[model samples]
Target: MPTLKINDVEVKVEPGTLLLDACAQAGFPVPSYCYHPTLTPVATCRMCVVEIKGQPKLATSCTTLAADGQEVFTESPAVKDGRAGVMEFLLINHPLDCPICDQAGECKLQDYSYQYGQDDSRMVEPKRRYRYEDLGAKIVIDKNRCIHCTRCVRFTKEISGTYELTVANRGSNLEVTTYAGRSMDENPLAGNVVDLCPVGALTSRDFRFNKRVWYLKPVPTINRHSPMANPMWADVDKNRVWRFRPRPQGTQVSTHYMFDEERLAWHRYDLDPAVRVATPVLRGAPASVEAVAAALREGATAVVGQGTFGCDSAQRLGDLASAPELRYGSGDRVVQIQFPALQLSSDGVLNRRGFSERGYRFGHLDELLAKVKGGEVRSVILLHDEAFSSRAEAAKLREIVEAAPFSLVLEPIPGELSGLATATLPVTTFLEEADFVIDHEGVLKRYQKALQAPKGVKTVAAWAKELAAATQAAHA
Candidate 1:
């Protein structure tokens, strides 16, 4: 262990820790654009500079390892002047187009500049300009706004194993681009570059110009698309999901940035007003939420809680059934073998463990129906969404569901299962609900709703609570 003082505060960390990280541990985060925990540390950006005792010149905190008794000053006048000079240089050739830039609100240049940048620029020369070029249908490159951080270039080579991006030319003419004339479309993880870009250099084609960053709100939630079940920041507005970004859990274990598929999965939740079941419905007739809940309780002698739901929702929904054993687990069966080293888990259901923990039996739907036929099970409460299952799995699920004496379906959006259900309730989509996550390993992570549910719908937790109160009264 080594003890170091950063800006008058002393903190103990393991030997060889970076001064920039030590300063952050001491409660002062130096501005950095080129440093990422997952990639090799490159202090080329000159953003994370700090004043260390006995050092003649300001040092790059990212690459400089803290030694025992090392006293570092991150707020000294000299350090501030150096940082300002670096910022000025970086912005000399940069375009002042934050409004049109896709990274507007979450852009590092915007945030760091506000915290440690001059309000005015002194550059008198004409700024360099380059027309935006399509890297692929997935990502676009605006070379003029690039800061030469090389994070995206390294990401393609190291993380994605695509090696599609590289630095061409040198000095003032240096530009990050694809190899020769290759496009990034072949790469499954291409969208991650947009996130790796410190500025507006790389942008997502799906997200650009669709909605301004500030207008969208970020909701913390688990990625149902990955095997590790990585947490993400799902940006949304008015119940429409905008985008998904990696919401890292500190710097300890690296949470690899999400892949292109995970990032673009936002479109699955873009609920169309016409397609969405705005309110509760029973056999094609409009009904109140209360009426749906009542019918579900009356019909469901058994319950099926899908693993796709969050932990709190799973617990509450599990309580709606006759007994814990009556709770069945169902999801679209998935078989994915091309496991990219990234968080690309083909499991599809992020909260499988949570449902299983509460006694929801998966692969036991046949037995559940037998119990139903024997009159041991009367009602079935289903927590379902259609995105994860294939056609065969769907058919099996449909058969089992139809066999139940009483069937109630809860869907974030209406699907075929909901159509055949005796009663259908509008349940909260992942973007529209606040709850906790239980990953494959049963690790619990909390998340909050990003958008408001449409008119008459409510979250599964809310519906289950109402059902439980009524069930107890009826039993009495």
Candidate 2:
């Protein structure tokens, strides 16, 4: 451990700890642009320069390691001037597009400029400009707004290892672009560059100009599309999710970036109100919860829960089954990606561990189907997500539903399985329900409700609890 004094405060940190981190731990977070914890520190931005007690000049705190008995000043006049100078240099070629830039509210450049930049520019020369270039179908590069921090360039080369992006030209005319004619569409992690950009240089084609960031409230959530169940922020507005962005969990590298497919899956949650099943139904006609509960209680019940749902839902749904052995897990969607380092598992089921912990067995759907056909199971209750189900699984599940005397399905969106059910209940989607899951790494992650569920729509846990109560009353 090394003891260091930051702004008259003494702190002890590990020998290899960066001065920037030590300062942060000492309650003085130095401003930075190109210093992501997961990435190698390039110290190109110079925004985190600090005055050392014995050094002749200010040092970039991000690249400097703390030494025993070292003294550093982050708020001194010299450090302030250094940061302001860097801000001025960065803004020299950077255009004034904050009024229309998508990164306005949350951009590091905007925040740093307000805190460290001069009121006016000293450069009398005309600012450089270039027409926006489309890197691929997924990303667009606006050269005018670029500060040349090269965060995106480094991300593509170092983190993603795609090497599709590069810095073209030199110094004053430097630009980040694709190789020759190759586009970034092939890169599954292309959307992350937009997040790495400190300014409005890189933008997502899907999310560009769709909504102002200030109006969107970020709700902490997890990405169910990935087996890792990576932490994320669901940017919601007017009770609708607009986008999903990586919400880094501490210094965990896996949570720092997400696949582009998972990033765009927010559209699935922006469901149409007319298409959603808002109430319980019996044989395609609207019915009451009590009637559906009555139907469930009359037969030998079993549950087939999709492993992508939360553990609480899985546990509650398991109780609805006539026997503990009747609880089955069904989700066979696997995401095949070239980069295995970024994806923890090819298995797309996010909550397989959660379901397994709740005694829901996977890969036994065939046995369950056979039992249903043999007249051992008289009724089936299925908890499903259409996105996670394959055609084969759907077909097998549909066969079981049809063979059973009665079937009850709890689905967020009506699909083939729901259509075959003798009784159907509307369940809240992940974005509309608060629950937790054990991810691929055995880490428990909780997600909060980001959007409001439709009237009469409830979570699987709530519905199952109600159904259990109804069954008990009927037996009494």
Candidate 3:
């Protein structure tokens, strides 16, 4: 460790750490545009300029390493002036399209401008313009807003290992683009570039023009799309999920960015207002939750709890079965992701590890089916989400649940099996519940409420606990 003074506050940092990172670790946030942790630092963006004791020129703090006895001034007048000058350069060609751009509220450029930029610009020439171009189905590139930081280019080279994006031409004509006739749709990690861009240069087509960034309330959540249960930002507004962004833990190692599929999974929960199940139903007719729970308690002799649910939901679903051993595990959607030390999961059901920890057995659906056929298990209760299960697995699940004499399906959103179920209890989606998920590695990542469950719907665990108490009272 080497001791360095940042803005006069002395701090020790591990060797080889970037000066900007060391400053950030010491509670001094260095403004940076080209310095993503996962990308190679080209020091193209001069946003992180800092004054050193002996250097005549302000060096880029992001690529600079601190040495013993180094005195760095992160907020000196000289450093401030340099940063302001860099901000001016960045805005020279940037289109003032914040009103229409998706990254307005969350854009680093927008924040840094107010903090370190001038209110008026000196540019008298006609502002540069470039038409918005689709890089692929997943990403849209706005060349005019780009600051030529090369963060996207570095990302494709260093993180994705694709090296697809490159700076073509020189100076004002330099543009980040994929090879001729190539599309980013082939890159599973393409969505990450959009996140890497500090400005509105890169935008997600799925998220663009849908919602303003400020209107979204961020909830720290885990990605259900990965086996590792990667931490993520669940941005919601007015009880609807608007987008998902990577919220990397300091050392969790799931990349500084999330895969495209994980980013897009937010769309699946787009509550279809017309199709959204509003109330608990008993054999397709509207019914009270109490009535549905009571009917479920009487009918279900076994349960297959989907592992896509949170730990709390798993516990309650396990309790719904006739016995603990009768509780089976579900959800077998596997996604094959091969990235460099990131996106660590093939199994899409992130909470499966948590559910299994609670005594639910996987690959044992046959045991439940045999029990149901032998008349030992007459009824079944299911907590399910069709998206987390593959078509083949869903077919198998439908077979097992339907095999029971009385099938009670609990779904947040109405599904195909809702019609087959003798009783259907509407349950809350993951966003509606305030719970935590333990990843495969036993990391208990807690997430807050992003959206409110529709009227007449409650969390899986709440419904189960209430039913269990009611059943016990009836028995007593």
Candidate 4:
């Protein structure tokens, strides 16, 4: 370990740790634009320049390694002057479009300018301008707002390995663009460039001009679209989710980025309130949850739980079955992608490990179907999300539901399976429920409720507890 002083505060760090990181660890975060931990550090943006006591000139902290007993000053007069100069040069050709820029509230340039830049620009020359260019259906690039950080270009080349983006031209005319006429639409991880951009240059077409970032409150959540169940933020406003952003775990490269499919999955949670199941139903007619639970208690019961849900919910749903062996798991829809570095697993079920740990057996739905056909199980409760199930798995579940003497389906949204059940109950979507899942790597990740569920819509655990109470009361 190397001991160093940042702003006169002594700190020790591992060998090879950048001064930028050492400063941050010492509670003095050096402003940096092109220094993402997962990406190779390029000292293009000189915002993190700091004064070292022994060095002749202020050094870029991002590229300078910490040394034992070294004295570094992050807030020194010389460091401040360097940062101000860098800020001035960066803003020279940048457009003053913060009012309409999507990255307004969270932009690094906006933050650094406020902290280190001069109030007025010295350059009276006209700022460079170019019309926004669509980088396929996913991304839009505005050249004027770019600071030439090359974060986006580096992300494509080093992380995605697509090599579609490059720095075109030199000096005053330099801009990030695709090769020749190639579009970034083919890249599964294209949307990540928007997150990597320190300025308003790269933007997501799906989220562009939709909502201001200041109004969106970020809620910590996990992406269910991938088996990795990657951590993310669900930016919600007025009880609706606006977008999903990658919430990278510290120093974990695997969690630093997410696929475009997972980023766009926020739309699935922004379902129409009118189309959601608001109350429990009995025989196709609206009824109380207690009524449905009482009806479900009359015969030998089994449960079919999809592994895409939380562990607590899965455990409670599993308890509704007559015996330990009666609980079965579903959801085997795996998505195959070209990148193994990005895609951790082909298993689409995010919480299969959680459900399995709770004693729910996978690939045994057919056995449950056999039991239902043979009269061993008379009542069945299915906890499911249609999005995670395939057509064939759904069809097989439908067969089991139709064959059972009594069936209850718990779903967040109304679907065909709900229509076939003897009783149906409204359940909270993942966005409206707080639960934890053991991901494919056997790491436990928790997601919190981002949006409010419709009135009378409860989580699976809540409904199962109520149902179990109702069943007990009927038996009593």
Candidate 5:
């Protein structure tokens, strides 16, 4: 451990901690652009300059390390003046596109300018300019607004390991661009550069000019499609999901960024309420939960739960099984991921560990099918999501559902198995319900409900409880 004095206040930090981080921990965060916690710190921005007691000149806090008994002043007169000078240089060639810029409300450049920048510019020369260019279908670059912080460049090299972005030219002509104007479409994590940029220079093509970010309320949630179960935000407005952004956690570099697949997966959950299955259907007609429950309780029931769902849903689904051994698991889809640092497992079933902990056995759906066909398990109840299940797994599940004398299917969206189900219940999507799951690391991650389910839609847990009550009443 090392002790330092920030603004005359005593602070202790772990060895080799950056002065920038120490100042932040001491309650005086310095402004920075090129200093991302997860990325390599180049200290090129010069906005985080601070005065040290024994140093002749102000030092860039980002590149400087805290030492024992070091006296650091984050808001000294010289440091403030140095930061203002840096802001002046950064804004010299920057454009005045704030009104039309998508980053207007949340831009770091705008915030730092007001705090440390001079009231007016001293430049007599015209501002440098370059027309906005499309990097690919996923990203757009506005060179005119770039401050050459190189955070995006470092992200591509260090984090994504896809060196698709680089700085071209030098000095005033320096610009961040793809190699020989190559497309970024091949980079799966290309969308993250937009998040890395401190200014409006980089933006996502899918979210460009869609809606002002301030208007969209960010709801904390997890990436259900990701095996890491990465925390993310569902930016919603008017009951519709507009976009998804990575919700970074403390010291977990993997949480700082997300894959483009998970970023764009919000569209699947932003389903149209009008077209969604709104009510319980029994043999093609609207029915009550009691009717569906009675039909499932007709004989010995075998349960199949997809591990993509939350643990609470798994626990409720397991309660429907006639015996513990009758509980089967599903969701065997595998995804290909390039960045190993961002994701450890490629298993598409994010909650497999959670379901397994709840007594659901995976990789044995074939046995359940045989039991159903042999008349040993007279009824079957399946909780499935077609997106995360392989064709073979889905087909096996379909055979079990088809073989059972009576079947009940619970799905947020109807799939192939829904057609053969003796009864069906419309369930809330993951976004419409709050629940938690245990990941491959045995870490419990919770996600809150982001959207309200349609009038007749209910969560799997809610439906399961109702069905259990109905079964008990019948016996009573």
Candidate 6:
């Protein structure tokens, strides 16, 4: 450990920790555009300069390591002047179109300019201009607002390993662009570059000009499409999710970025609560939860819960089975791309470990099917979502449901098996409920409710409790 004084406050950090990070630990954060925890520290922005007691020149805190007994001043006169100078040069050719820019409210250049920049510019020459260029169907590049931080270029090279973006030309004409004007559509993680941009130079094609950043409130959530179940923010307005972004956790580099599929997965959950299925259906007609529960309790019942659901959902679904061993697991989707840096597992089932720990047996669907057809298990209760299941796995589940004499399907979204069941109950989606899950590393991650469920819709846990009580009362 090394003890350092940042802005007159003493702090201790592990060895090899960056001075910029140490300063942040001490509550005096030195801002920088090119210094991301996940990316290499380029120090090209020159915005994180700090004055060292014995150093002759102001040192870049991003590249400097903290040392014992070191005294660093982040807000000294010399450091302030240097930052103001850097801010001035960065704005020399930058456009003043913040009103129309997508990054207006969250742009670093705008914040730093108001804090450390001069009100007037020294250069009278007209600002350099270039028409916005589309980097394929995913991103749009506006060179006029660029600050030349090279963060996007480094992201493609280091994190995604796509090497699709690069910096072209010299000092005054430096521009970030794709190689040979190639499109970024082939890059599975291309949308992350837009997040790395400190200015409005890079914008997502899907989200640009759609809505202002300030109007949307970020709701903490998790990526259901990811195997790691990475945390994310669902930017919602008026109960509609507009977009998703990586929610970084502590110093873990993998949490700083996500796959494009995960980034855009929120669209699948953006259902119209007004039009969503709000009531239980029995034999293709409207019915009550009691009716569905009565039909399911006719004989011995077996439960098959997909591993993509929350731990609370799994616990309640397991209780529907006649015995503990009657609980089965489902879901067999696998992610093809294996980005070793970010993805922890290739299996797409997010909460398989959580379900397995709750006495839910996986990879035994065939055995369960045999028991259902042999008149041992007369009824089946399935808690499923089709998005996380493969066609083959879905076919197997459909067979199991159809073989049972009385089957009750519970789903947030209606699927093929839901149509085959004797009865179906509409449940609230994960976004509309609050629950937690255990990841591959046994880490308990909790997600809060981001949307309001419809009037008649309920969570799996809530529905399961009602069904259990109704069935017990009927027996009594």
By lDDT, who's the top model here?
6
The parts of candidate 6 lying over 4 Å away from their true place are none
lDDT for each residue of candidate 6 in 1-476, tens digit (9 for 90 to 100): 89988888999999999999999999999989888888889899999999999999999999999999999999999999999999999988887899999998999998989999998999899888875666888888888888888999999899888888898888777788779878889989888988999998889988989899998999998888888889999899988889999999987877889888888887888898767778899999999989988888778999999999999999998999999999999999898865787877888998999999999999999998999999999999999999888888888998998899989998888878888989988898889999999888899999999988888999999999999999999999
Clash totals for all models, in order?
A: 8, 0, 0, 0, 0, 0
Query: Which candidate model has the greater TM-score, 3 or 4?
Result: 4
Candidate 5: residue pairs that collide: none
- Please, what is the whole-model Cα lDDT of each candidate in the order they appear? 0.79, 0.89, 0.82, 0.89, 0.89, 0.90
TM-score between candidate 6 and the true structure: 0.97
TM, every model: 0.90, 0.97, 0.94, 0.97, 0.97, 0.97
Clashing pairs for model 1 are: 226-345, 227-345, 300-379, 300-380, 301-378, 301-379, 302-379, 332-389
Question: Residues 272-373, candidate 5, lDDT per residue (tens digit)?
Answer: 988988889999899998888888877799889999999999999899899999999999989786777887888989999999998999999889888888
Q: What shift in Å separates residue 133 of candidate 1 from its native position after superposition? A: 3.4
lDDT of 3 by residue, 283-391 (tens): 6688766676566565437888888788888887788777788888888888776874885667778888888998888888887888888888877888888888888
How do the residues 291-397 of candidate 2 rate in per-residue lDDT, one tens digit apiece?
Answer: 98888777688899999999999999999989989999999999886676677788899899899988899999999988988888889999998899899998898
Shift of residue 44 alpha carbon in model 6, Å:
0.8
Instruction: Report the lDDT tens digits of candidate 1 across residue range 1-476.
Output: 99988888989998878888888888998899999887888898998999988989999999999899999999999999998888888989988899788889889998888878899989898987765556878888899999999999888777777788899888888888778778999887788888888898988888889888888878777776765678788887776788898888775333657767777888887877666676667767987656665665654367777777788888888887766678778875463644355544557677778888888888887887678777676667778777776777678668766876667788886789987887777777877777877876667877777777777678988878877776666667
